[model samples]
Target: MGSVELPGPPRAARPPRPARAPRPRRTIRRRALPYLLIAPTVLALAAVLGYPLVDLVVLSFQDMTRRELFSGATPPWAGLAHYRSILSDGFFWTVVGRTALFTVACVAATMVLSLLVALLMRRVSPWVRTVMTGVLVAVWAMPVMVAASIFRWLSDADYGVVNWLLGLLPGLDFSKHNWFENPWQGFAVITGVVVWGAVPFAALTLQAALSQVPAELEEAALVDGARPGQLFRHVTWPVIKPSAVLVTSLCAIWDFGVFNQIWLMRGGQPEKDYYLLGVYSFIESFAVNRYSAGAAIAVLTVLMLLGGAVVYVRQLVHLGAAE
Candidate 1:
């Protein structure tokens, strides 16, 4: 046995295993960095937007009178009394119609004008494009209040530039026209202002979209004996459809909840001409001291804006599917 043990081969030693590279350490900062960046914005929105929204919801359901609001009493459950009142109220319906008309008119005018401007700008020389852009910027740069003031003066019966210009025209009589006193004229003025204000953005957006149309595509259409109008319909229209829809959607949304422009134009006339949801709500809350009623009107307006957004989303989805 001893001899056998001596004959045993020398024990072979294994070589050392190579060391592995350490995995990258994830710090609290590294793991949470993305969330941290967004957390502040989320928190801010929660405090500012979220709190007020919740408050408005609660305010909408709970009855709040100026007297009760001023005095510190918990409001009793109004249920949908405010909403019911708004629904039954004749004035409210009138304002609803007015707002709808304004929205429609503004959308139509803005779309048509913007499309035309975009088309022209898309094909013009650099200097011409620059001039167009400069003019748009100049108009767009004016403050809302200033623009409103200008419109107010321009539409005035006593000293309107429009009336003056109309007087100059051979067939027109503008001796004393109160533009704000008539709903139709008021609407026209409002729509004109809104469209004029919106055109620059639409033109810029549409021009960019038009620029993306391949030159070859248009050239090919021409080679195929396609006239300018035919080429527009068959080629450019499809290419610009998405952009146009986006602009339209935006215009719809904006006009749906418009406040200052319409309010300023309405000028506090209880007459048929002087009512829009925004103006009515302001009058109710401030002039008449009907806080809950005003809140109801506000809620309705919000629903309208929300509806517009829903429509926009649907259009965008449809467009995506089409693509």
Candidate 2:
């Protein structure tokens, strides 16, 4: 009772543990780490690419001729004159249409073939998958110029392996057939080269994405009697869709700017029919000596590419955030 009486005095409430100070420094560091990591890349890209882009845009607004270039005279500004001329020209529109069509053909073919190859990789034995992966890596590692050269040889009119093989088909002869004589057939060969180079990367990417699909989900769907197409649409496609969209966007950008295959195939002198935006720009600049016009075309090409670039960046950000 005495001890209880001594405890009767209300003990001062223990001071609330001082609220922990917010570690502003650590919080800042954590927030800043990502930007810091990417800074070098941003700086390097700026150093490498910034000046050219700025110069291109400036040049697009000027009237620069080869005469001025050779004489080392300052180019005169032309405001939107070059853009007006290009936008008004029917031939420019034709080239734009052709470029669009070519890009679609190449991208569509590449996505289909790559998806098939990726699915095949999933179905094969581990050794087969390994072999396929090695082949894809080898193909991906091969330089674009070298691949273009090989395709040139393979499609050579006189001694092409392709022509020889096609000649073997009964009631058909492709021997000494000029693939580039018809623009349609020529573009088909070009599409083949584009798809060949593109498929390996896309297939590899899709294969990696496919690996992340939940097996349990697929099995459950199968057990529920889902058809193959239904299974893919419901279970497999969702997992791979992001990768596919990214790949398709990239393919669109690349194929939209295709130049090397057409140029090399046509022996560095692509015809008017073969003029994608890049080829058109080159022809306008060097071939026709319209520097300002070329720059304008380049600007337009960049604008067209922006849509795909935007899609790619958004998908990449989504992927990063999801992880």
Candidate 3:
């Protein structure tokens, strides 16, 4: 019985464990990879933007004028005098208000229109979708200058296509209408141009985001008697929210600093009424030769933008947590 107990079933062999890299080395590699990947971008941006920013800040502290600029003479330090002047100027506050309102209007219009277009693209047939995508891509590829030029021509004071089209309607006479005569009307036209150019990018991005929404979830919601709004609110919105946030912030920043559209529309000399932060800075620097003041304005503008970005990011964090 003792001898019979010696020949039991053979035990299964275990595979040998592979040797692991050291934990410190692996941890360091993992930690450094992201920074390494982003190093080139950081270098490129610093090379391009870093020097100019430093110079701007230095210039803001100096009483730089055209005389000193052309003569290559170092301007005397003016301390915070320029900033004090800008802060005290009522016109500066007005421009800030105008810029903010303009940005809000343009961003709102662009997002609404873009969302509608994205939804339209999603619901259409394949062929129609293809054609729509093609059109959007073409639009997105158009340069800002070209788009602004086209819009300017369309809303020209005389012999404009917009006026012609409006004239075609009975009891409406838009012929020879001067869109820029009224600041409100001019701003409306500029907002249209901005929205037109911004919509394609936003719509395309949203369309892509919409594709990530699970068809199964949407179907289940529909099956449960969810209304279209309810379905979108409960299912689609959560998926597209991040993309929407990105587009919105970018649009806000871009619109807030809009210069070329207004400048080009006004033939490189935007009137006081049409002056945004960008134009105001440029005019103060180049037009009025108040370089120090202009630099101060520019710095203030950047601070405002950064503040807004911080607020927006905080809001997004809170929203994400609440969801």
Leading candidate by TM-score? 2
What tens digits encode model 2's per-residue C-alpha lDDT throughout 5-54?
34467778888889888878988999999999999999999999999999
lDDT of 3 by residue, 145-175 (tens): 8988998899987879999999999999998
Cα distance off (Å), candidate 2, residue 113:
0.7
Candidate 3: which stretches are off by over 4 Å? 1-22, 311-323
Q: How many residue pairs clash in each candidate?
A: 0, 0, 0
Candidate 1's TM-score reads 0.83
Model 2 / residue 144 / CA error / Å: 1.7
Candidates sorted by TM-score, descending order? 2, 3, 1
Segments of candidate 1 deviating more than 4 angstroms: 1-42, 266-272, 314-323
- Model 2: residue 211 alpha-carbon error in angstroms: 0.8
Candidate 3 clash pair list: none
The candidate that wins on lDDT is 2
Locate the minimum summed-lDDT window of 10 residues in model 2: 1-10
Candidate models: Cα lDDT each: 0.82, 0.93, 0.92
- Displacement of residue 261 (Cα, Å) in model 1 is 0.8
